[model samples]
Target chain A: MNLYGVRAIYKFEMARMRRTIMQSVLAPVITTSLYFVVFGSAIGSRMGAIENISYGAYIIPGLVMLSLLMQSISNASFGIYMPKFSGTIYEVLSAPVSYAEIVLGYVGAAATKSVILGVIILITARFFVDYHVLHPFWMLSFLVLTAVTFSLFGFIIGIWADGFEKLQIVPMMVVTPLVFLGGTFYSIDMLPQVWQTISLFNPVVYLISGFRWAFYGVSDVHVGISVGMTVVFLAACMATVWWIFKTGYRLRS
Target chain B: MQPDISVKHLNKVYGGGFQALKDVNLEIYPGEIFALLGPNGAGKTTLISIICGIVNKTDGEIRAAGHNIVTDYRSAREAIGLVPQELHTDAFERVWDAVSFSRGLFGKPPKPSHIEKVLKDLSLWDKRNNRIMSLSGGMKRRVMIAKALSHEPRILFLDEPTAGVDVELRRDMWEMVRKLRENGTTIILTTHYIEEAEEMADRIGVIREGEIILVEEKNQLMSKLGKKELRLQLQNPLDKVPGELTLEPVELSEDGYELIYTFDAQEQQAGVARLLRTLGELDIEYRDLQTRESSLEEIFVGLVHE
Candidate 1:
């Protein structure tokens, strides 16, 4: 109900992104662009087509997903964590804002930033490869959904972390490795039969697969299953956030 | 008139099983400066935090501006602004944006003129465009005050507003506080400085061991509990109090060179007259006599120790 409060927080967070444009927006965009140059141009030239699509075009969606997942988590986590660390969180908590509004403001802004970064990376990728979006609507939908879900996940990490080191632990140790092993540069279909079966268990595989399907209408898993898994994860993150606010966990004493 | 804030049977037990607040009750009248005096862990911050909706109470009810802080959180919180003890702000943010954003957080529409006035009042108008990190310590504290007043709430809670502040800023802050009171804002401040309470508080409340030991009008508490001391420079040294003066609250100085008489200030006339008459009749000569009224600091120490 407190739309003004939500807008204020959203604007404040977005402004922070502007202030740290090089770190927040430009770094990821440039890094993903380099991935296109290295992986798409250099490595793809030596590989055969994937699912009847050129190798360079094939990795575009995956590259964008890599950046999206990382950016979403890092942005959201750092957004909330900085406030906690600096103690300005008391200002927000003491205001008239509701818990839902606070989440919407922070997570929404984080997702917005990630989604913008994803789109920019996609544009940058276009210069290196000839990719087509078989379903542009679905591509956009998947982009937003992934950003929001991961941002929510990041929000949880931000709250659960008590120190700066803990903040980077999940993104650096768990998420980055998962994204790399989730077929960002290669298809799970190319893996050994047993490894492919095991790759199905890696959650990032579903996201990348579903996102790639939006680009070329082909995926390692059923697109429907990928979307369903994402929705399930989204619901779980929402439930966890609800519990955090209800119990005043970490946010209050 | 109904109190601006009413706390009933409040209790706060931390997750670690440390009881931070006992069954405490207090009512603060509207438009009055009330000072909560206590040491570091006396639960002054806890009580303010619970009322501000920042900390959850283990058991109790608090109503601000007639809204229950728990059930009607938004409304209750809208009526209150808190200047916390910690000096924390968005280091990257400009003063203008920080104060303006705080107002917006309370769901108030942006009013540039009002923000300008608040900035001017706090002597921060010139630094409105400056990043908070670039400001000095006193300037940052003023920025905090500006942010608290941005929403123009009816009630303001200043938790150690003058702690670590320079004397000049402290004086300015006190003057600003009085100006706010004139504007009809109810102010509740917690402080380690008893002189601050003595100077500004219309009513003073002392908290000790998570309980409110006393709350009374500042003048009344001073007069009731405040003792007057009479010091006599004796012509002759004495090892003990004279037997005739034993019934009075009298004691001999450790050096045995002076006689000290302690009495309630309310009975100043009769008590001093009788003491002087007794001294005259006993032939107890004194080269000098001095009378001193007990300060709020002494009274506070006495109550806390008791």
Candidate 2:
């Protein structure tokens, strides 16, 4: 809980982030912009609006979600994996820095990257297609929550992963597919009744839906349910992360 | 005052029932250099890992500066510093950043002058700004020491600190370790080089097959267990030993030109003077003679063989 320990870890992680700014910070900004161009302008211009919103406006939440998901996973996973790979984990474990301090430092760094990217996409979306936030506070709330929750999930992934290839498995195979199928570009309502019901089980559906609700004051799923699911996930992920740190799972083992 | 470090009945059994340590007991006193020597896979690294809290012991009690390593880890860990055998560090981090960051890990307030003194003592001040990956192997080793000493721990464990190092660097490191001890830090070193123990250890412990074969003060261990030899040079090449020489414990050289008689110097009657008289009675011609004293290496080899 000491801020000094947190600051030490934070500075170490940010230094790593700074070392690869092109990969961590800038790459996401550029990738999200491309999504705006191709999906928002080229694709959205031809297709009509969904739920009375423009095609450009419809994909903004999804794009933000995409960046947030990838960056959070990448940041946290790399943060933990690199230390293991480079053998610096020994130094950190031997230090007076507590497990909680280590987690906070890494998760905080991941959140920093994801949140910054989320904000950049939000600002960029304004240029492509003008949109008004029905509830700016809700928008900010979901943005911060999604960033923190996913970062924690990524932190868990980092702890669980043994090799570089394993680091990518969760985010690439699991998180990416969940984000794409969660109705980022299209609505689950457009599908048949059974498929829509099945899509309801994907946890990412709630995150995107909740963010969308924050934007236009309307969403496919109930806003309360989406928010509730996010809260549940945040708790689950934080608990799992804390347990890993407490048990010294892969770290001390 | 309590011992600087202590381990009682320490044991570790790996997953396939491979016992790495069995009923090991050891203590390191304050301001003394204790060397742990053993062949590979003899549990030197495992013992160190458990003491440093890097590896879990199957059953044991370990305390550093009166703090149990398992229950009171923070204080125990804070009381000691470890330099692992591997040269692992954040490759991208600058040398200064790496050392300073390691200090911060101990929750110590930043002190610029103390860090400067550490870097200077290790002769690493010039390379402080260089990235760790760019440093040479010897330089990297110094950085490891710098990082370990940054937190100002009372006890330091150096696991094979001189492996793969040149003689000069090895000597320099030994000197630095002595200086650290002079300043009131207890040092525990594990080395493959027996000479390091011979030259530096106040006490030595030898382990083999996950068991501590022997532990004793260096000079006492040598005198108590060390064997000495008298090498007799023949005045003329002997085709065979005289029948009277059979009564004595001696080894004939392959060429049959010299006789090697080994005996415990600590024994009351070494029989060396009698052997020479017998040689003279047999009219054995001798041109020269020399004495060979057993070294710690020979003692270590002897114990491990046992």
Candidate 3:
């Protein structure tokens, strides 16, 4: 209801992103570009195509998803965590703003940043590899949906984490390993029969598979199921955030 | 006029079963400075936090500016400006942006001239463009005050506004508080320094063991509880107080060189005159007499101990 309050928080967070442009925007772009050079060019030359698509172009969507997921979570988590750490959260909590507005402001800005990074990585990919968007509308939709879902997850993580070390634990120990194992570089069909079954259980696989489908119309899982799983995760994160605010968990005492 | 803030039967019990506040009741009048005096862990901060809607109360009903704090939190919160005890600000933010943003958080439209006035009043106009991290400690505290005032709320809660501040800033803060009061803002502050309470508070409340032990007008509390002492130097040593002087609460110094009389300041004329008359009738000789009135600090210490 308070649009000005939301705008103020959103602008402040976006300004922080602008202030730390190198770390926030450039680092992810450069890191993903290196993935293209090493995995797309060096390794793809040896391996043949999958589904008649060039190996270099096959990994573009996966690489963009990798960066998008990490950046979304990191941006949203750090945005909320810094306020908690510095005790400025008291100001926001005591103000006239509602919990919904606070979440929207922070998560919206974080998703905006992630989507921008995703698009930039996609453009950067065009220079190194040949790729096409079979469904441009679905590609944009998946990009936005993934960014928003992961950003919500990061918001919960920010509230749940009590220390800086805990903030990095999830992104480092869990998310990064899952991204690598989710067929970012190769198809899951190449794995052993049993390993392929286990890869289906990894949630990141659905995200990458669906995003890759948007790019070249080839996927390890049906695109409909991937979209359904993303929506389910988004709803779950939304429910968790609602519970956190309702119980004043880690926010009030 | 109705009280600006009214709290009744307020109680707060933490998760570990530690009761931070117990059956507390208070009513703060509009346009007056009320000082909540308590030692560390006495729940001063808890009380303020609850009224501001930051902490959830275990059980209580509180109304701020005629709105229930729980049921109508938005309107109640909009009427209050809280300068918390901790000095926390966005380190990378410029002073102007921080203050403007705070105003917007209260759903107030941008008033650049008003922001400029507040900054000038706090002497932070020159540093408006500087990052908060680059300012001095005193200046940062001022910025906190500036942020609190940005929305121009009807009531202001300054929790230990002068803690860790130097003498100059302390004086400036007091002056600013007075100016705000003149402009019709009710102020409530908590402090460990009795001197601060004495210097500014129109009324005083002392909290101990999670309960408000006393609340009274500053002058009335002083006259009612404050005691005065009269010390008389004897020209010659005496072994004991004379029989006539025994009716008064008089004591002979251990060395038998002086007599000390303690009496309420409110009854100073009658009690001291009677004591002097008794001394004259007894032919007691004294070289000199000195009188001292107990300060608010002494009264506060006595009340807390009691």
Best by DockQ: 1
Model with the higher lDDT, candidate 1 or 2: 1
List, residue by residue over B133-209, the lDDT tens digit for candidate 2. 99999999999999999989999999999999999999999999999999999999999999999999999999898
* Chain B TM (all candidates): 0.97, 0.96, 0.96
lDDT of 3: 0.94
Q: Best to worst by lDDT, what's the order?
A: 3, 1, 2
- Name the TM-score of candidate 2: 0.96
lDDT of 2: 0.88
Candidate 1 positional error at B141, Å: 0.9
Per-prediction DockQ comes to: 0.89, 0.67, 0.83
Which sections of candidate 3 miss by over 4 Å?
A: none
DockQ, cand. 1: 0.89
Give Cα distance to truth, residue B174, candidate 2, Å. Answer: 0.6
Compared with the true structure, what per-residue lDDT tens digits does model 1 show for residues A61-175?
8889988988899989999999999999999889888889999999999999999999999988889888899999999999999999999999999999999999899999999
Worst 10 residues of 3 chain A by lDDT: A38-47
Q: Indicate the worst ten consecutive residues by lDDT in candidate 1 chain B.
A: B266-275
Per-model chain A TM:
0.98, 0.96, 0.98
Off by over 4 Å in 2: B268-270
Across A1-253, the per-residue lDDT of candidate 3 in tens digits comes to 8888898889989999999999999999999989888888888778799999999999898899999999999999999999999999988999888899999999999999999999999999888887899999999999999999999999999999999998999999999999999998889988999999999999999999999998889999999999999999999999999999999999989
Superior by lDDT: candidate 1 or candidate 3 = 3
